[model samples]
Target: MAKSVAPGRPNQFLRNLNSKIACIPMMLTALVIFLGGTVWTVIYSFTNSKLLPRATFVGFDQYERLWAASRWIISIQNLAIYGVLCLIFSLLIGFVLAALMDQKIRFENTFRTIFLYPFALSFIVTGLVWQWVLNPEYGVQGVVRSLGWESFTFDPLYTPEIVIYGILIAGLWQGTGLVMCLMLAGLRGIDEDIWKAARVDGIPMWKTYIFIVIPMMRPVFITTLVLIASGIVKLYDLVVAQTSGGPGNASEVPAKYVYDYMFQAQNLGQGFAASTMMLLTVAIIVVPWAYLEFGGRKRV
Candidate 1:
């Protein structure tokens, strides 16, 4: 027999009874629709579903075919190349632009708007506009040729080797502005006391930025990283509107591969497998890094 035990802390969940009851529908939708749909996609990925999702459990048969496909291989390679370069260049350009903008320059508002204007356009619009500009017929290559350079050959969309870089250029143009804005906000949030302390110590300005300012703005950097990573993973519309995996599938990305398999190829199993692999990629590759970077209670 046990003595009478004291009750534990009151359930905060019970305190919000009215709100919780109101949120039941939302909770049900989240559980049954979103979570259920995700579970369905993952479970069915193991089956050899075709035009319609057939419940023929094939135990990794779809995954085996997905890995063996040349298109998937090319897509992965392209994603790797595109992800790495995009991260480096976008961060570099954004930070540099943000630093320059922080100099308290005149007409700062005008300059910032000019820089960020491209970000206002959707990826589809951006891709189409760039497609025409990059085209050799009426684009830069043709325009340059008209200026007495008959051998001008700047056709990136058609060049299999460098087509990925071509897409990278457009991506950077449209994306770096947001990064710059984020970095600028971070930089501004740096306390004046820090700068004064650095000045009193006769620290070099660049060294102050590197050693003090950057470390202090860890949250901003993390936010920008998430944004850029999301853009990299969802990189379909731009590729579709711009290159369409042309020049022999040189710039085919994973999203496009998944879409093609699901919709065009009519292989739901293969598409589901590819998509599930994407989720795994984000989980295995990105999730850990993010957790390590920003997950802990410790602040920079």
Candidate 2:
């Protein structure tokens, strides 16, 4: 009693068949490698895996130990301080630079290249350069002292209290250029008519930007937020190249904690647990924002 397929209807399954077939390998790799690896890491995190992964399930002992460790606690605190400051300063400075660049200034290309040059260098290079620049005896402090001020103090890498800020400086210098470019592109995408209307309405330029332009660039802001947040989460190499978590683990971040525990300390379970916590933190921040941003949209 079932009706046959309609002659006028196109077969949905066969549509884009070649493209879908071509993507099978990539899909399989993502599923088997990334997803599978994540699952494996999460599973072994609950076990007492040391030296190598084992099946000695230890319930949340690894996590409890991780939390109780003073080093881990300091790292979390440092990450929070670093993340908040980095997000704020990077966005503010980048947007300001972008807004200035959008004013049709002379030698814009030269200025942009100069501003963005730091971004072209690797984080390791940036860290090394900043380390030298921030060195008390050999860099800024020395230069200022030689100019007649002997008591000028400017070392941060060796100072436990402000070591994270030293790394933050390097991070901002290396990252702000890219953020500026992204903001510039977003600003450029804004309609000129909007500006004209604002002018005709006697609205201040700053007011127009704050009230209208920024709201329109929501997608760009979201994209930049994701990039910056991801970078903040995996901040390791810069810390290693600059301070190596020195000055009594003051500059230690979550990623470096995970790495040291996994490789140096040979505590795989503890490392995995820390990593799982990082994943959970990212999920907690990202999931709700993503749902709010896209969940209400109707799928085509």
Candidate 3:
């Protein structure tokens, strides 16, 4: 009888010795920096550490104060408004623009470049440019007044009711291009045979897109959704440059609140609590989506 070889020692992690060695530094960096800092913040969030971190645990007092603040409440409301509107409009405009570009039109590259050029600029730059453009005396209002439309009041930034919408417009201008690029890439990945089949079945273009093409592009849509959602959450710089949460804090966002309480107000515990709440919110939204997308048994 042939002697059976012991399963080659079961292939240790050291088998890929060079690759594992290369990844050691990065793995340690992530664990030490990201994980360690997160843990530290979460621990301190339970304390009343003002101006600096301390071990004086207060058990939800900071969180209660955070919720009671009007500015923080306004910030959450603003974030919710901006987040919802941003996701809807960005996806709609981006997909529409992508579909148009996918129509084999002439100068497609030129159009794509023109559309995507805004994304290359930083958000601060975009916000400042829009700030000027939305200025009542020197921007769209002025130009329209110059052309003799005297009563056309379109100053969203100055109006307490619509200042957030003004910021939303600027955000869309800066971000929709990236979304379009992503959607266009997804569109390009569609198999030509699928289109042929759709045509052969006498399906209208809109129906084909709604029923089949979009479902096939689920990965791309999910990627775009995450990008937009993250941008919505971290919307501090643009609001700062554009309106500074002005018009009586109509455009205040949670990130700005975190910054103000942390650094400007010297209330570290409150800021930490707010940041922890933000993290919890993100987890609440992401965990369910992740489980639905990655978990679940297949039907027989």
- Report the number of the highest-TM-score candidate: 2
In angstroms, the error of model 3 at 288 is 1.1
Q: What TM-score quantifies how close candidate 2 is to the native fold?
A: 0.95
TM-score of each: 0.92, 0.95, 0.94
Task: Give Cα-based local distance difference scores for all models.
Answer: 0.92, 0.93, 0.93
Summarize candidate 1's per-residue lDDT along 1-300 as a digit string, tens digits: 123333675566577899999999999999999889889999999998888998999998889999999989999999999999999999999999999999999999998998899999999898999899999999999999999999989989999999998899899999999899999999999999999999999999999989999999989998999899889998999999999998888999999998998999999999999999988888897877967766864765
Enumerate residue pairs that collide in model 1.
none
Model 1 lDDT-worst window of ten: 1-10
Candidate 1 residues lying further than 4 Å off, grouped into runs, are 1-8, 18-29, 293-295, 298-300
Q: Candidate 2 has which clashing residue pairs, if any?
A: none
**Backbone collision count in every prediction?**
0, 0, 0
Residues 273-298 of candidate 3: C-alpha lDDT, one tens digit per residue: 99999999999999999888877534
How high is the lDDT of residue 196 in model 3?
100
How much is the lDDT of residue 181 in candidate 1? 94
TM-score-superior candidate, 2 or 3: 2
